[model samples]
Target: MLFVTHVVPVNEPGQPRLDREAVWEGLVMKANNALPFVPAMSECEVVERHGDSSFDRAIRIQGDPYRERITLEAPHRVVFTRLSGPILGTIANEIEGDGDDMQLRFSFALVIAGTPGNSQGEEDYAKNMTGMYIAALEGTLDAMRRIAVDNAA
Candidate 1:
């Protein structure tokens, strides 16, 4: 098992601030509305949605398609578990407020043992890929912040 965590602060003065619940709502809404925060994600659509807490989506990133099941705990966190794909693991995002703004803390754990061949090399690759994924997510956070600010105007 390999885990990576990254924290991005969603704070900028003059930008409209969303309460915790609103932030969660926005996050779920974004998942349905074209996933603009993730430039690498070419397509995203909800295959199963039952309010904010449970949903399954098929996402295509760089031409590879995969499905993820997300379970949300309002105002604070969402857990994403891969149902089928090249990767196997769970990714979680924990959100909270910082004064008028909020912070998004992402934690990812990849179950490297499930990989085919399951060699040391695969473990190393999973670790490297985890780092890259976290970096991309940080970029997504930046894009989200920009969108939030723009929406406020």
Candidate 2:
């Protein structure tokens, strides 16, 4: 498994003055049909809302559908475990601290399964995917910040 973590400080102008809980409640929870960060993805189809802590959804990306089971820890983190997809493992978005001191971070602990027997091929694949994933995360942070600010108001 490869674990990658990215953190970005929210310091954009005109940002809303909302705390971690408020951001989680207003923006994160309400974002159901589409993910706030992922680019070039279709709207998600929510399968089940398992109480306040978790939910299940299928999101289509590049014509392929990926399913995940998501769990929320109020005021702080949201964890997504791939239930069915090309990648298997977990992605966690965590908000550290409170108020103006909050920092947003994403930890991606994932593995590309089903590709056994070829160690070199797996290494190449992992390298390529990690680069792509990091690029995607960069694009996502700005959007997430925007959403957090907008909803925080």
Candidate 3:
């Protein structure tokens, strides 16, 4: 899998704080719909909320259902596993710790199989994919942080 994680540190040292669950609640459950950080190309809905904050939703990007019933977990760390085509497996989004600050991260892990008939260097593919995924993820988290900061006051 082409595993990649992007982290964006929240600026405030220790302001109004929320637990990991609350953070998950806002970022996953509500932020994608009600909150401003939501991308115009997509929409998100939660079908479940458990101890670890697992939820099911169909991501409609550009009015097309690209993903259905995507399962994202918040156990120990936020992990989103996409169950769809072209994507073998991924831990889409997460938030890690930095004392009082939160480091938002996401991944683009791809499952590739080596073909006997035709061969392609997996390392080169992995490197290209990693760069693209990390850039996009970092931009996403930066946008989210801006939105959160704008509303925090």
Q: Judged by lDDT, which candidate is best?
A: 1
> Quick one: RMSD of model 1?
3.3
> Where does model 2 exceed 4 Å of error?
12-18, 116-141, 144-153
Top candidate on TM-score is 1
Per-residue CA lDDT of model 1 for 1-153, tens digit only, reads 666787766655654555565566656665554366666678888899877479898998668788898887766787888898876789877887655557878788766445544678777876777666666566655556566678778
Query: Which order, best to worst by lDDT?
Result: 1, 2, 3
Per-residue accuracy of model 3 over 85-148 as CA lDDT, tens digit each: 3445655566687446766666665665451222355567667666655654554544555555
Q: What's the TM-score of every candidate structure?
A: 0.75, 0.74, 0.55
Report how far residue 16 has shifted in candidate 3, in Å.
13
Give per-residue CA lDDT, model 2, range 14-116, as digits (tens).
Answer: 7545555555663364346445556656668789999877899888765767898888777677788889888788987777776567777768877777776
lDDT of each: 0.70, 0.68, 0.52
Better of 1 and 2 by lDDT: 1
Question: Clashes in candidate 2: how many?
Answer: 0
Which parts of model 1 have CA positions greater than 4 angstroms off?
Answer: 12-22, 112-120
Model 1: weakest 10-residue lDDT segment is: 25-34
Itemize residue pairs with steric clashes in candidate 1.
Answer: none
